[model samples]
Target chain A: MQIYRFEDKKPFMEKLEELLKSGFTSRQLEIYLPHPDHEIEELVEEYWPKSKLKFITLAGGLSGCSAGFAFTIFTSLDWPLITSGKPLVSIPPYIVIAFELTILFGALFSLGGFLLLSRLPSFKQIFHPEEYGNEFVIKILREET
Target chain B: MSHKDTGVVNQEVNAKSAAQVKDQMERDILAAIKKPKPVYWLGLLITITMTLIGAAAWAYQIKTGMGVAGIRNPVGWGVYITDFVFWVGIAHSGTLISAILFLFRARFRNRFNRSAEAMTVFAVMTAGLFPLIHLGRVWFFYWLFPYPTQRLLWVNFRSPLVWDVFAVSTYFTVSAIFWYIGLVPDIAILRRVRTGWQKLAYAFGSLGWKGTFKQWQHYNQIYKYLAALATPLVLSVHSVVSWDFAMGIIPGWHTTIFAPYFVAGAIFSGMAMVFTLVIPMRKFFRLEKYITVDDFEKAAKLLLFTGMIVGYAYIVEFCLAMYSGNPFERDQFIYRAVGDYAFTYWLMIACNVVTPLTLFVRKLRRNIKYLFIISFFVNIGMWLERFNIVVISLAHDFDPYAWGTYTPSIIEVAITVGSFGWFLTWFLLFSKTLPVLPITELKEEAE
Candidate 1:
């Protein structure tokens, strides 16, 4: 892995555009900035647009809702007792739990997906320039011949 | 120096080069984390002492039982529940500033969102303690959760208290994630800037963020959605909290307006707290350039808006009670204004409604001294408002024979004071550790 640091964004962008035009795969190059930039993100997205991130969040939320409903409804049935003279399978109140669980699992899945997709908690040292946090740096992984 | 003396508004925004902007932000914000003054330690010492006192009080209560807390059959929810509601209300503005303002693209929030979000987390932590303390059998607190037991026991899904458990816990989870996600880039900055133990800590906390466009893209996407998810919780959490009272059959507690009323009141109290905390912090941290009077004025406008909403809720509550001519509701409203606890009711009105009205004066809104003083009043008034709502309603219930006035015991008062100490300790520690200002976001705004 070769890391190049640029004091200005212009050189970084030019190098990025050159790398992209040369048909380098998105995985071969990583661009880091001091802060988020819309245009650069657009350029990155133009190359690597497909991501399965949302599916994890969606699946987690749906399952969370299902689990929440099952837990609340089944628990009442297990007891076979009524407190407020309402139906044993009271759906109105149970929806609160479902809603809460939906958010909880959705958030957890989204965070999990983010960590997994980003390959985070990365203990293995990669080529990261110290200036990358303040300035800009682009890292390119060389293909072994 | 007074912020006005700094002439922050006169500084030219467009004059600075990109490098200059970066340097200035780094110098100003990072100093708060790297340098500690004597005042910081003094404040920490005081808060720690208060927290210890509160813990001792809780210990005393546990040893003697709930009888030591002055709660009786009539006024069952006393200062502990009031403190719970007040702290929960104070937690609202953090989400409002971080999530709601981010959704609306309010640039002003960039300066103060980190501190506000931290307040939200700490305030919620403090608020969560009250329910446990109120539970005479503090050890039985886990029973609030729905877990299958040998007795086939389960929490009733029909209870608003159960809803509160889910709502508050989810709110905390989402808010904490939102807060931590926002910290990643800043933590990444600290990772490179610090050394030794601090470097290792930031290294782990930052999740190895590189400035890569790809990482930024994913971070931005996830953050946006988290903000989206948290927005509804800002409304729902407090609404569910209101239901804790609204679901009760007590005359004053059974109003349909409780949800919106409580939500508005929460935002109002929370904003006042933002003012209370930020005014002193900006001064102490010498962040006048970043957190200007203009920022305070904008927040004051919001404080005024929510304050008006709260004031309107109060009036509408009384009007509805009178118009309904339901003898029970009418009597309860009358009792609130003129009963034994009428001092608290009037105090709530004066602090929340009357004091906030002064902000309509442009001069007062911009004046730091006036704004700080008024915010202090609002904090006290909001606490009293919760006190009036919780205690007054229960005291003057439909059964006239059951009517009774109640006062908090010394233990309850100590715990209440301790809750502030606990909250302040976390906040003060946070200020010294994290960049109180969102350094990355502030730089983004500067550019």
Candidate 2:
């Protein structure tokens, strides 16, 4: 195993790009950053596809919208009592419910998707993991076979 | 030294400086979470005592009955409702800073977003308590939920109260998740730095965030989506709160403009509260380096902008009420200005409208001391604003015979004081426990 660390992002990006150009597959290499950097994200994505968290958010939002409307309409119909002489099913007010649920579920599902994709709450990593302090690190795990 | 040797030395010096900056950023930001001083304990002690007073007052109300509150036949909704609106309004600025400013790519947001979001969660928690307290029984609070019953009765979906239940609960959940997501990486940093139980706690809180490329890729995407999601959610939550009044046939309460008007006022008051909390917090935490005066100036601009909108809303409300050709509405507007609650009405105008105008002056905009003083005024003014809208309208409705005045009983006053205590207690604990500033975001900006 080989490790390279840089204190500055500029030199760090340069080194990563140079290594990539020297024919190291993105999969064979591991990277650590103190903070998220878009430039590094784009560079890594050139080898891998982008994150699929959006689909999860979309699914959560759509279902929430439907469930909101469905629950409100169903319950309204379930009792069939109309006060204020309004319609038994009021779309205007139900729209508010649907809208709120859309955001609530979208946010929640996005968190779950992120955790699943990132493999968070990993017991092994939580108790015992490699630690790096304020460095941009690159680890190459195998020789170029 | 030759030119080539000088160039090599310059590069070394630059690299060393960059490393020092990184170290300083971590040390400065994390320093807030260190062992507290006597002053910190004193503040906590005071807040906790206030919280108990509030709790004890609440217990008194529960035991004595709703009669202990000044809320009676005519002015049924009083200080409790005002507090609900005020606190919920307070939560708005957090969303405005963390989610809305984030979308706009306002760099100033980094300095205040963590605390603002914390305020959002805490304020909403405080706000959520009022409806139950107002419910009198408080035990039947679950009746607000839309569950089936033996008689097959269901909660009125059309009622704005039900909408409020959905809106506020959703706001609380989403705000919390957004806050925790932001904290994960920072907690990971703490996990590395601290030892013993603190390290274990942070490790659990961080969920083992290693700052890997894959983790960040997903983190960035979710954060963006959450921000996008939160912007509308924040607006809608306040709008729903407004609808609780707007849907009513009460003269002052019913207005088409209430949605935008309340939304703007929410942001305005919320911003002032941010200034109120953050100004002292910055001094106490010694975060002047990270949270600079320039950042406060930028946020002041937001407060100024929103304050103008709120002021405009006040004028528009009056003009529309007078021109509305409805005597009830017209009387409601007149009573707001010159009636029993007239003092509160003018105070709201002075604080919400006039005080913020100072920020238009460049000198005053940057003056943190002046901003802090004005923040207190705005907080009081906004609370009075809600009080005027809720109590004034209810105090004097259509029939002159039914009109009645309200003076909050001592119980109501104690509960109000207690609410502040409760909110401050949570905030003080948060400051000592969690990373008050978003260290990861600050590092990103520094880089």
Best by TM-score: 2
Off by over 4 Å in 1: A1-4, A125-131, A143-145, B1-17
Candidate 2 ranges beyond 4 A from true positions: A22-26, B1-17
**Can you give the lDDT of residue B47 in candidate 1?**
99
Tens digits of lDDT, candidate 2, B352-447: 999889888988988899999999989998999999999999998899999999999999999999999999999998998888888888777666
Best by DockQ: 2
What TM-score goes with each of the models? 0.95, 0.96
- Score candidate 2 by TM-score against the native: 0.96
State the lDDT at B52 in candidate 2.
Answer: 92
Across A4-94, the per-residue lDDT of candidate 1 in tens digits comes to 8775566777888877777778667767678876666777667667456778878878998999999999888988888879999999889
Summing lDDT over every window of 10 consecutive residues in candidate 2 chain B, give the lowest-scoring window: B1-10
Q: Per-prediction DockQ scores?
A: 0.50, 0.78
For candidate 1, the per-residue lDDT at B184 reads: 84
Q: Per-residue lDDT for B137-236 in model 1, tens only?
A: 8898999998879998788998999999999888888889989989988988888888788888888888776656666767777787778778887898
